[model samples]
Target: MFTLFKRSIVLILLGLLWENASRFSSINPAFCPPFTEVLQAWWELAVSGDLWVEFSASIRRSLAGFSLALLIGIPLGLLIGWYPLVRDLLNPTFEVFRNTARLALLPVFILFLGIGEISKITIVFYACIIPILLNTIAAVKSVDLLLIKSARSMNVSSFKLFLKVIFPASIPSIFTGIRMAGTGCILVLIAAEMVGAREGLGFLITYSQFNFQIAEMYAGILTISALGLIVNQGLILLEQRFSRWKQLPK
Candidate 1:
């Protein structure tokens, strides 16, 4: 409760400073509109339902890319981690692609897939996959040798040993990767939308800025920040729930 109170107080102070800067500082209002004006612009968009439409478009694309990453990354990570031959065969390829920036391929994607939804989704998927795959591999590799030996002593089959021991032990690390990938998905999708999309919060902000609608631009920025925060908090809750067996740091 005390922490929450301190945070609230700090936020309020920041808002006051922002309002004063817009109202009284040397900064031009055209570039830095008052916070209340930004709130008003947000309210207008919300009432017209335009906010929801654009927000949903971005959300759908992000989720699609994230889901693809999860489906492909987890199994591939596990396979590479569990089998030495598979690791030797694929790790080099994975390293090459992972080291390359996903955004640098945006133009290539556009050339092949066009500036359509496919290109955008591809960029997001590429951005999200690296963190998830690497994290899963690390998690699997970090499983205790003693645990594996104990499971082997119990006469467990190879498949059963993996399912009963390795997979469970790696859940916490997998969730960490998932959380990082989720953030990557959002960020990459937003950048993709800003470049080529006609709709989405990113487009909305770019359009507003180009039109010199400072309040609306700030509102879009605020919306994106708030949305990211909410999503991350939700992921934290899920991580806590799924990794309940792990000893969490205080």
Candidate 2:
């Protein structure tokens, strides 16, 4: 506990500053309520079941989109990275689309998919897939040359070589991409929900703001930040587990 306090002393001081400012400073509490009010709002939302409903809707969409990206990204990335012809052919297309802002395509998605779950999920998928794909490609390409040569010298079959060496070595890098995409997908989903949705954290935030429920708005914002932290931490645990597994003997 002492060590933890030492690590978080700065955050504790900031919280104190925020509370003091809200209580004593000349700033408008309407625009920026005390941190305690935000916490109280979060508790109210949680107890009333509003937080769970909104969080579930947002997380469900985010999970769907992120899952789809992972399903496609890893295999496709490996294919592109491993084959020179495929890489050469698709590199230009990937570069062009990747550089294009995903939010810019929101209207296109809405037009095609409508203001529904599909459009939101597709947007999240679009936002997440690029980083995941690029990272997986790099992971595949970056596999150690020495390992490849050793396997080849032992007359390892091409298929066996990949299963035994390249794929395992690439796992950490792939997880790095997963971690990146995990955090990003949440923010993207929030934006998507804000654009069109009756129930979601994003909706809750916008609704609260429009209605001037400043405390609740802050609560919603804090909830999103908490969600991002949880997702990142969960991904970190998975990464650590996989990295450990990869180190074990086959």
Candidate 3:
């Protein structure tokens, strides 16, 4: 705890120095407000409940999209990784889709899904799928072949082999994929909301920009950074809990 506190203090001091330097420079505050002013705006927004509503909406949309991606990506990846024929058949198409920029599809999504929650969610889902699928495939493929062969030689049931050997081996990789997907979801949701949404942190930032509320915009950006940190830490905690068996000596 003391270490953490010390690190935080160092960061705070660095931020203060940066803010002071920027403020004293010829740079306009509208482009980059002082940290103190931004924090003040953040406090006001938090107390007004506006921040809460936007934060909630953003979280909901990101989670929904991430869930959908996981549901579809994991199973399909497992199948492909387990079967050579399936992998060969799907690899080309999967590679093509993965290489395509998800943001480039925003215009098409807007056309089909419209400028609603559907469009935003679809963007998030699309952005999340590639990482989850690729990670799942890698995880499944990384299971030790000798262990699988031993299980088969012992007449272990296919289902049992997967449960006892494959699943455990793949867990760390799956968690890695989930963390990547979480970050992707947040990034995609921000872009989607900026395009068309009334209530979200993305919307708040864009709106504040248009209204020349530089401090408020900075506050919104800080909120996003905090949210991202919380999400990453939450995933780290979950990974530690579930993959405790994989832990190594420090």
Candidate 4:
């Protein structure tokens, strides 16, 4: 609670500084609109229900992309990490693809998939998959040797050993991947929206800027920041719940 209070104070101070710059300093209001004007613009959008529409649309796309990544990346990563043959065949390709900037493929995806929902969602999926896959592979490969030895000493079957020892140990690293992928989903979704979106916070900001609505543009940006904060907090809570075993003293 005290941490949250300190954060709020910092934000309040920043807001006051921004308001002063826009209203009293030599800064041009055309470029840096007062914070109150941005808030008013946000309120107007909220009252008309436009804000919710864009917010929901972006959230849906982000969640859908992230969900697909998790479903596919985790299993594939497990296979690659578990099997030397699979790793030999796929690791080179994975390294190449993940090293490429996902945004650089945005044009390729748009060219092939067209400027539609499919294109946007596909880009988001592409952005999310690599981190999760890499982290899962690391998690599986880095499992403690002692755990494996103990399980083998008990004459555990291969499948049972994996389920009882490897999977649990790998979970913490897997959650790190999940958190990274979630952030990537939002960022890629926003970028995808900028290219060909009709209904998203990215679209709202672009549209507002095109029409010289500075306040509205700022409101859209603020909304995106707020959404990122909420998503990060949710992921943190999930990590805490699922990775609680890691809290035990080593």
List residue ranges in candidate 1 displaced over 4 A.
1-3, 247-250
Task: Using lDDT as the measure, name the better of candidate 3 and candidate 4.
Answer: 4
List the candidates' TM-scores in order. Answer: 0.94, 0.95, 0.94, 0.95
lDDT of 3 by residue, 11-91 (tens): 889788858866898877778878888999999999999999999999999998999998999888887888789999999
Ranking by TM-score: 4, 2, 1, 3
Candidate 2 lDDT over residue span 1-250, tens digit each: 9998998899889888988899899988889899899899999999999999999999999999999999998888988988899999999999998899988888899999998999999999998999899899999999999999999999999999988898888999999899999998998889988888888999999999899999999899989988998899999999888788656577
* lDDT scores of the candidates, listed in order: 0.89, 0.91, 0.90, 0.90
Instruction: Kindly list the per-residue Cα lDDT of model 1 for residues 110-170, writing each as its tens digit.
Output: 8899888888888888998999999999999999999999999999999999998999899
- Model 3 steric clash total: 0
Question: After superposition on all CA atoms, how large is the RMSD of candidate 2?
Answer: 2.0
The 10-residue segment of model 1 with minimum total lDDT is 240-249
Candidate 4 residue lDDT tens string, 1-250: 9988887998999999999999999999998899999999999999999999999999988888888898999999988988899999999999999899999999999999998888888888889899999999999999999999999999999999888888888988998988888888888888888888899988998899999999999999999998888888898898889778879787
Backbone clash pairs for candidate 1 read none
- Model 4 ranges with Cα > 4 A deviation: none
lDDT of 3: 0.90
